[model samples]
Target: MRLALAQLNPVVGDLRGNAERILAAARSASAEGATLLLTPELSLWGYPPRDLLLQPARLALQSAVLDGLVEQLDGLCSLLVGVALPCDDDRAPGLYNGIALVDQGGWRGVARKQLLPSYDVFDERRYFRPGDGPCLLTLEEGERLGLTICEDLWVEDALQRERLAGPDPIAALVEAKPDLLINLAASPFDPSKPALRRQLAGQAARRLNCPVVYLNQVGGNDELVFDGSSLVVAPDGSTLLELPACREAVQVWDSSGPQQATAPLSQTPCREELLLRALVLGVRDYAGKCGFQRALLGLSGGIDSALVAVIAAAALGPENISALLMPSPWSSSGSINDATALANRLNIKTHTLPIQGLMQGFDTSLTPALGQQPQGVTAENLQSRIRGTLLMAVANQQGQLLLTTGNKSELAVGYCTLYGDMNGGLAVIGDLYKTSVFALCDWIDSPEARNCREDLGLPQQGELVGEAIRRKPPSAELRPDQKDSDSLPDYSELDPLLKGLIQERTTPQALVAAGHDIPLVERVQRLLQRAEFKRRQAAPLLKVSPQAFGSGWRLPIAAGGLCSAGPD
Candidate 1:
């Protein structure tokens, strides 16, 4: 059988649009003489449609959308489209995450997702009820096809510690002894997930003793970015073909033909390149879906803003990006020059809005009300607020989306000001640690990134983030000669500490035992706890890490049980 995989992006809740995407792909596949087409899971309603699945009207629309897809597939190739099937039993949850087979005139359910994940970013058990057994589809050519959803094939993988307790879907399918195995998925992007997926598919192929076709979704939906690295693996656990990552693509594989030599399956991109592509895709989709044509950010000439400017320029065209040099009285001349030079390199427009005047005006107006001039942290935050307000006014007047430039290290310990540097419609790098911010910049300047940068249409020659800006000490420029290290621990020491606490969920004693300083670990713990309120109000950050500060990190603002070093 000639099968085509439609690795396309889908907008959540846009049933008609999603169906149109599927139909368009089906027509192309049919033109190419493909007998069957496979789509990503939840292609009709999009992945993690979340609460949208709860609406009665949406369920009604889904039925109509399915009927339309049946009509559209008439006289064309057979299609396996992902959808949510309503439950016939009242005792079960209202829906079953399933795939429908649409041939010439009719469609029927081929397989329901057996494994419903409930850990990390997934909460499938809240809405979907597991299927009781395996599903096998028989094609007109008399070939048996074993169907599985995203998590159904993940049970045997030891890396996924949060496996469901239901019957092993892969084991059940193996018992049926199908000729070919297929998995439809909407797996989100993580730097290491693609390799892990390849391993899982190889294991499944070896167990089933048949070629496995894996199709994954590609796009950014809310906090998730799906990297559609679909693959076809031979029964001997060798990859026959692997699709591109972080983009939409369609390709065909002839099961009857000889194995084709393609790129090495085990090769993965450098961590820096993988992360950069994910961020670019996330920014483009978020801005485009939110209906913003242009993006603007306060360019402080620091590492964070420079990196964000680079990503924004790449995501939205450089012409569609604008930067504001909101220099305070404490801002250095080198800072302004560095920002301007970077902006020139990226071919983006820049506006110089010195906030010293606004700073003085605000101090004068607030002195009488408070009986004292705002000083220290208050004064520092005032400068940030002035800059944020100016950027917001410009963004509002010009109808551009504002991007915040705070990184994970600063955000973890309350180093960022709320409604100031933290003010923006989207936080592009809020999940990146300060150390990661510097490393990514270094990678961008290195020869390894030249081809990737050029492919993304970013400035290819020389350094995109100049040497001067990168080598300088990290500072906010809100106060005179203020260094980040003067207030917080050095990022080299702090990033791992934060990672242990936040990502690893390590207690203070455990971190201290792991070579972190006792006093520093305790202080960092207190700071992280105190900063929960600030992070609560910050912009929605793009989640790249396994444990991002957004939806996954759910800590209470008023909690007092801090991670302790010992019996205090």
Candidate 2:
């Protein structure tokens, strides 16, 4: 039997639209002689429908959408569609994250998701009741098919540092002797996730002694970006087929059909290349889904903004991207020149808005209240706020989505000002550390990024980020001769410490034991905790790392039991 994987991108709450997307993929797969089409988990309503699942009206609409599919998909092919199954009994959470088998006869709930992930960006447990046990769907031809949803296949204790406690769906399926195991997912992108997913599928395939197909949803939903690197693994743990990442695809596989020369497995791109594509996809979907045709950013000639400019050009075409050069009096001529040069290279439109006058005016207005001019950090922040206000005004007038260019390091330490440089609808690289920003910029200027650039519809020739921007010392240019190092540790040192504290969740004492300076570690820890208010108010950033500040990091703004002192 030919099995098809329909990797789709669905908009949350758009039941009709999502159902149509499923049918389109189903029709295309049936045309290619596929007998069964498998879609990602919750493909009908999109993943993490969140509060939308609570509305009785939308749940009722879900039923109507499924009915439409039953009629339109008749005689085409049997399909396994992910859905929310409503229970009639008085279960606290009335819905089960489920899969349905739809064919000429009708549709029925076949397999429900056993593991409902609650950690990080997922809150599935809030809306779903876990399935009771393993599910086995027997086809008309008496072919037994084992079924599971996203987290069901992620039971490997060794691969993951922590495993979800639940019934082992794969283990239960071992005695069922199924011909195939299919796991539907809406797994978001993390640099380590692709390989980890493949390994998980391979292990399940070997355990079941049958082919395992893992289909994942692709595209950006809010802050989460899913890279659909779906795959099929043979019983021997070798990959039989692998789909492309960061896009939608539908392809069929037949083991009984004539054997052709097996193609080499596709290699995952370098970290920089993967990140660029993921971010571009994130930005593109975020803007398109939010009804923004153009994007605006405050281009400071700094590495962060320069990289965002390149990404914006790639995501929403160069013609649709606009940059505002809000240079203060202290801004260097070289910085201004660099910003203009970078914009010219990417073919994005740029407008200069000198904020020197605005800075003086603010000082004049505030002097009467304080009986003195706003000085030091107060003065520096005024410059940022002036630029932010101008960017917001332009974005509003032009109907462009404002993109924030702050990196993770600055954000982690509260180095950025509130309602100032941190202002935007989306933070493009808020998960990327300042050091990673430099590395990505360097890669953008290198030959390796050329092909990815061309594929992303960006300019492929010459240096995209340029050497001057890449080599310049990191600075906000808020004050004369001001550098980031003046206020914070060097990125080379700070980023690792930040990563340890944020991603690794290392204690200050543990960090100190690991050779980070005790005083610096404690200071960084305090800054990170104190900056929670700012992060809480910041824009939703594109999540590239496993732990980003948005939705996922649920630290309290007003709590502290921070550990003190270095390791003995």
Candidate 3:
């Protein structure tokens, strides 16, 4: 049997549009002489449709959409479409995250997801009830197929220790001894996930002693980005085919074919390149899906905004991106010139809106209300607000999506200004640490990034970010002679500390014992906790790392459990 894998991008809650996407892929697959078509998890409503699954109107529309799919697939081919199945029992969760097989005859539920992950960004338990056991579908030719959803195939106790209590779906399915196993997944992207998924699939294929097909969703939805590296693993645990990462693709696999040697996984791009592609895809999908053709950002000539500009130009065409240089009284000439140079290199439009006048006006107006002029951090924040207001005005006037330019390190320590520099529809690099920002910029300017830049439609020639911007000392330029180092520790030192605290969940003493200064660790810890309020109000940021400040990093702003010195 020839099976077509539809690694597609779906818009959440757009039942009509998502159904149309599936139908289009099915027609193409049918033309390619494929007998069966497989789609990712929840392709009809998009993955993690969240509360949309609970809406009465959406529940009512589900049946109509399924009927439409059946009509489209009639006489063309058999399609396994991921959809939400409403339960008849009122005591149940009211729905099952399930797959329905639609053939020329009719459609019916074939399988439902058994393992509902509640950890991290996933809240599946809130919407879906677990399936009882393995579901086997028999074709007209007497070919038996075993079906599983995203988490069903992930039964590795060592890898998923928290989920060990759940019944092993793969083991249960293996007992049925079907000819083939197919998994529909909407797994989100993490740098380490692709390799981990490959290991899991190989293990499953070996255990079942049958060919395994894994179909994954591709696209960015809000903060999550899904990399669709769909694949077909032979019965001997050899990979016959591997789809492209961070892209939408379709490929056909023959179940009768001999088991081929596994392809080398070394061909996967290095960590930096993979991350760049993910971010670019995230920005593109978020902007396009949210209905923004154009994007704009405040260009400070510093590394953060420069990197965001490059990403924006690559995501939306350079012509579609605009940069506003809102220099304040303290802004340096070199900073302004550097910003202009970077914009010129990227071929993006730029407008100068010096904020010195706005700063003075604000000082005069607020003198009476404050009984004195705003100074120190307040004064510095006022400058950021002025620049932010101008960026917003330009973005609003031109109907462009504004991109925020803050990084993880600053955000962790509360170094960013809320509603001021934090104003944006999307935080493009909020998941990257300040040190990572520098490293990425360095790589972008180097020879290694040529192919990636060209592939992404960025300037492939010469240095795109340039040496001047990359070499300049990091500064916000909100005040004269100001540097990030004035208030915060060097990023090289701070980034590792933040990683230990945020990602590793290490305590103060533990960090100190690992060679960090006690006072500095405690101070940084306090800043991170105090800054939760600011992060709470910040724009939705693209998540690239294992632990990002958005959705996954759940912490209460008012809560207090500050680490203190111990007997050590």
Identify the leading candidate in terms of lDDT. 2
Would you list the rank order by lDDT, best first? 2, 1, 3
**Considering only N, C-alpha and C atoms within 3 Å, which residue pairs clash in candidate 3?**
none
Weakest lDDT window of 10 consecutive positions for candidate 3: 156-165
Supply the global lDDT for candidate 2.
0.90
Better candidate number, 2 or 3, judged by lDDT:
2
**Who is ahead in TM-score, 1 or 2?**
2
Identify the runs in model 1 with alpha carbons over 4 angstroms from their true place.
259-267
- Candidate 2: list runs displaced more than 4 Å: 257-261
lDDT digits (tens) for residues 1-568 of candidate 3: 9899999999999999998888888888889888999999999989879999889899899889888887777667689999998888886578999999988677889998898988778889889999998888889999999999999888886654345358888899777898999999999987888877877888899999998899999999999999898888888877888888899887777788767844464377777787888899999999999999999999988999999999999888899999998887788999999999999999999989877788889999999999999988999999888878888888898899999999999899999998799999999999999888888888988899999999999988899888888888898877779899999999888999999999888877888888888888888899999999999999999988888998888999998778773435
Q: Worst lDDT window (10 residues) for model 1?
A: 259-268
lDDT of each: 0.89, 0.90, 0.88
Predicted candidate 2 versus true structure: per-residue lDDT over 116-172, tens digit per residue: 889999999889999999999999888889999999999999888778998999999
Give me the overall lDDT of model 3: 0.88
How would you encode candidate 1's per-residue C-alpha lDDT over 1-568 as one tens digit per residue? 8999999999999999999999999999888999999999999889979889989999999888888888878767888999998899776467899999987778888899998988778888888998889889988889999999999988874756466788887788887888889999999887888888888898999899998899999888888889898999888878898888888988888888766544555456788998999999999999988899899998988999999999999999999999999887788999999999999999999989877778889989999998999988999989888888888899999999999999999999999998899999999999899999999999999999998999899978899999998999999977788898899988999999999989888878888778888889989999999999999999998888888988778899998867578645
TM-score of each: 0.97, 0.98, 0.97
